[model samples]
Target: GDDDHEGEFGASSGGAFHEGEVAFDEVAQEADDDRDTISLVVVGHVDAGKSTLNGHLLYALGYVDQKVMHRNERDSKVMGKASFAFAWLMDGNSDERERGVTIDVGVNTFATEHRRIQLLDAPGHKDFVPNMISGAAQADAAVLVIDGSTGEFESGFHAGGQTIEHTVLVRSLGVQQLIVAVNKMDNVGYSQERFDEIKKEVGAFVKRAGYRAEDVSFVPVSGFKGENLLERKEEALNKWYCGPTLVELIDRLHPPVRAVDQSMRMVVGDVFKTQGLGLCVAGKLDAGAVRVGDSLVCRPGDVEAVVRSVDKHGKRRRHARAGDSVTLALNGDREELDNVRVGNVLCCPRNPIPMVCSFLAQILTFDIAVPLTIGFQGVMYWQSVNEPVVLNRLLCLVDKQSGEISRKRPRAIGSSSTAIVQVTCQRAVCLERFADYKQLGRFTLREGGSSVAA
Candidate 1:
């Protein structure tokens, strides 16, 4: 439910609404010149130490204090899970803490020497893969944490495991940079052989998933022992692995090019109400810039709202640009604002994002039980939106090496094939062509609880 409002937000009866109509090109670069901001998603199989690793990183970076750490330890011990103290820092929900598994996306912020990272901690279990896809959609890079203990790595890397699925999903969502963190090395006695074995296997898979060799790096870490995260102190670990620590590796990552000068478009991730700020929405800016007092429209409902305030990483700011994860307090009609939900896009009124029920997409199919033909049905995942969709037409199949059309109007396309397909959604979706907007255009198709294509 939303509150009742009378007039347009930030608008006067005199018809003067020019407060937020400034030229963005002149000031987009100067807005956040202090450092580059990167939205990073942490993903891996269940119990792979994704949360624990990031929890330790936060403590090491001084984001969590001693008092908070002691409280978490006391509470976790009372719950009979003393080992989850660090993980409890990120998994705050009671359901997640009680079950000892992450059920939703855990978000936090930290900074390196030259970059600010907005961390999106995704759930590892199969039931929450939808939440993981939403988190990955907003990220510029990802770190796939793999358990390094003897049989654990094999189980997670083998067929029907979340490791390969997570790897493929992130790459498909346009996450070009990757870091395969080999976690729990201490359980293997900090063995270099074990670390190398994981690196070799994961390296091959990432390559097959379309990640370049230079864009991918491997690091051995002990999330529980807090080794090689911020600093390497163990003699056993330092014996053979002399590469950069996890923090150092993150510091070296290159920020992706953004579309700050383009039209404003931000995909909503979550919506909630604050004590004083009536209705607030959090999301990542896909392109252009947003500022307080700017009038914007939310698609799928044509809800108009004004940016009452802007907060980036919990700090209020006047302006924010593309690649920045922010929460905005929007002022508008209570009934209209109530329609604002996750997967909706907020953009400039001059050019609202296109909302369509169908679009042409180029998808790379994975191993499927049957060939994909016209009327094939599945859920299409785009950003934070997932809708029931059906394949309308099988346009053609393209040859991988030659990038030329191999067949026209094929009867069906099977696994390991590339094809131009027409897809129709159950409802209207805000999107652009892949050539126009990569973040808005790319999507994943999941059928029967498994990712089928992307």
Candidate 2:
């Protein structure tokens, strides 16, 4: 049985086919299109008001009109969920509305004074963590929502909390900038003591999770009452907390440098048929640029397709560059369209991505209950792709400080250890070396439904 599963996804030893350069066409520049864009994902435990906070932010920014809010108020009240009125603005699905829990990634776009923000509202429930991973994979930064009510913060921040898991997940996926929004301060009567307690504890954990003190920021706000979001309207909050509002902090986030020189690559998040567009695939461009009439290919199948049009946040554009969440109108027949699935990578046809079944990875183990050993099976999540994988070999443990081999042929790796190990996937999937591509190479490993390593 062990032999049957070895190299199920890719070869035991191999490298990507070629390191060829792709010819990219110059994109037509649009006038005054200089505003930077940032993809932000809101994450935390269930009922932490992630959706409510973001939903109200959109409304306060005038993205949602009064008529819509009034209707949502009436409808949510009828369903005995008046508190979910703001959340309904983000949670569009009927099931999510009725259940009062976000099940899928709710995406919406808004702009600050200096930035165009594509907000991704991630599900907080543990069952939906995989979905959250999908959202975090696309995000350049994260907004970790924390409940400030008594006992709530402890529950979400302690061992086995989604807060801890989310922090690690986002950081492992290459999200550098973090904004910890201490939501529901109204419950604590806007107490400075409570806010400081949360800040101190969360701040320490964030550092341990690989975030610098400078990159991590904290803000106190009431998601339900809508205070300290756009402005610190509450007199109580102003006495002790004289800091930037949530919107202000968001506007201050640094945009990541785009990889315009690399070949075009985008991982498909969603695929659907449109009336006029024929077929469309939505994703954040990971590298290079794409324009109308550009030829592309989807990996694992190597199916060729053409870009019919490019659109960002529903606005038609002639081209889109790296770090943009865009929908590409693709031209293809029925058979070709059927082959394009989520987790499939789209790149320039001249240089298609490689499919790998096995590769060596440098992973950092968390507080896993069981030690990682040879033949250990777990799910590997890379970008939008999740595959069954086996730890085919134990290479060696490396010292974090010295950058030297700690041990050769380590039989087992425990918690908080760094090791280079060979992993085999159940099937071939497209991935690049982390040294070559930071975003494309990083991944998380989950075992027995818990995130064990990254």
Candidate 3:
């Protein structure tokens, strides 16, 4: 059903709606404070020590005190899994602890002398890859944890390894800067030779994934012993590796810039109702700003609600801007806010975001057994929006890399090939042309429940 229809912005055939200007009141501008924050996601293969490394870093930085450490130690020992003492700080969920693995993204905030960090600790298991994607969508940079134990690096980097998939995914999802932490060097005796070997292999692959060599950095450390995480302690191989600790390297990362003055728009990643607070929606604002008493519209639902309050990093504020992860408490009939669910976008009325049923996109398929063609159906994951979609037409096959159209209508687009195609959904959903907004425009296609394209 490729039916053409007209609505708010007229026919949704061509040209994306360009949100012009917005008049954010002075009070709305008061909470317009800039944050020197780095939204960093921690990712790697299962048991790569992602949670251990992040948990220990927070503890070492005084974010987690001795009392919590003692409690975690006693509880881990009782469970006969003492090594999880550090991981307990992040894996607070009972199921994750029972399974001895991280299944959900754990968010925590900590500050360095130079910058504030919003750390997203993502699960590394293949089963939890979708959860990882959710966390990565909110990050500006990523820290890829790799197990340096004997035979472990190869296992995670080989053909069926999560390392390869994760490396490709983060790069494809717009993470330009990546820190490849060669963790658990203690298991390998902190050998510089091993580190060099890993650096050469991973460095080459990440480069092919569109990351510049300079933007991809390597750090050798032992998350278990907390070595080279803060202050570099003299180790057996200190002579060969004298680079700054992980903390120093992170602090040196380029601070992310914000778009606080553009048209107000924020994607709802989670929704809930509090005891005292009304309906609360949480997500990162891609552009513009919002404040208390500000009127906003939720698209697709088209439900209008006023902003009752803004909470940024646990502090209730009068306003908040782009580049921030905030919770907006709505002031209206409780049903209105309750009706607004995750994947719903809140925007300024003046600059209404385009919500459509179908659109054209440039897709790069993965190495799959089957090729893509007309009538292909898959789940489309755009931010928090996960919906089934159909490939209505194979508009044209394009160059694998350059994206130049090569065929008007190919019988099928093979694996690892690129093409511009038209896709339709059963119901209307929000999507913008990739040319307009990278965050809202980009998405991944999954068929048979596996990621098929990006």
Per-structure clash totals for the candidates: 0, 3, 0
lDDT of 2 by residue, 1-454 (tens): 0001111111111112121211122345355357798999999988899999999999999999899999999999999999999999999889999899999999999989999999999999988999999899999899999999999988888756799899988988888899999999999989999999899999999998888899999999999999999988888899999999999999999988766667788999899988867788999988877877777888878887777777886667767887888998787666977889999998977666778999999889988888999999999988878999999999999998887899999999999999999999878989987755678888999987799999
**Cα RMSD to native, each candidate?**
6.8, 7.1, 6.5
Q: TM-score of every model? A: 0.92, 0.92, 0.90
Taking the tens digit of each residue's C-alpha lDDT, what string does model 1 give over 151-237? 999888896779999998998888889999999999999999999888998898888888989999999999998999999999998
lDDT of 3 at 61: 94
Positional deviation of residue 376's Cα in model 1 after best superposition, in angstroms: 1.2
Give the lowest summed-lDDT range of ten residues in model 1: 1-10
Clashes of 1: 0
lDDT of each: 0.86, 0.86, 0.80
Model 3 lowest lDDT segment of ten? 1-10
**Regions of model 2 farther than 4 Å from truth:** 1-32
Candidate 3 lDDT tens digits, 95-177: 99999999988999887777778899999888887888878877888999999998999999985778877777776677788
Q: Answer with 2 or 3, whichever has the higher lDDT.
A: 2
- Model 3 spans > 4 angstroms off: 1-35, 400-402
Q: Indicate whether candidate 1 or candidate 3 has the larger lDDT.
A: 1
TM-score (C-alpha, index-matched) for candidate 1: 0.92
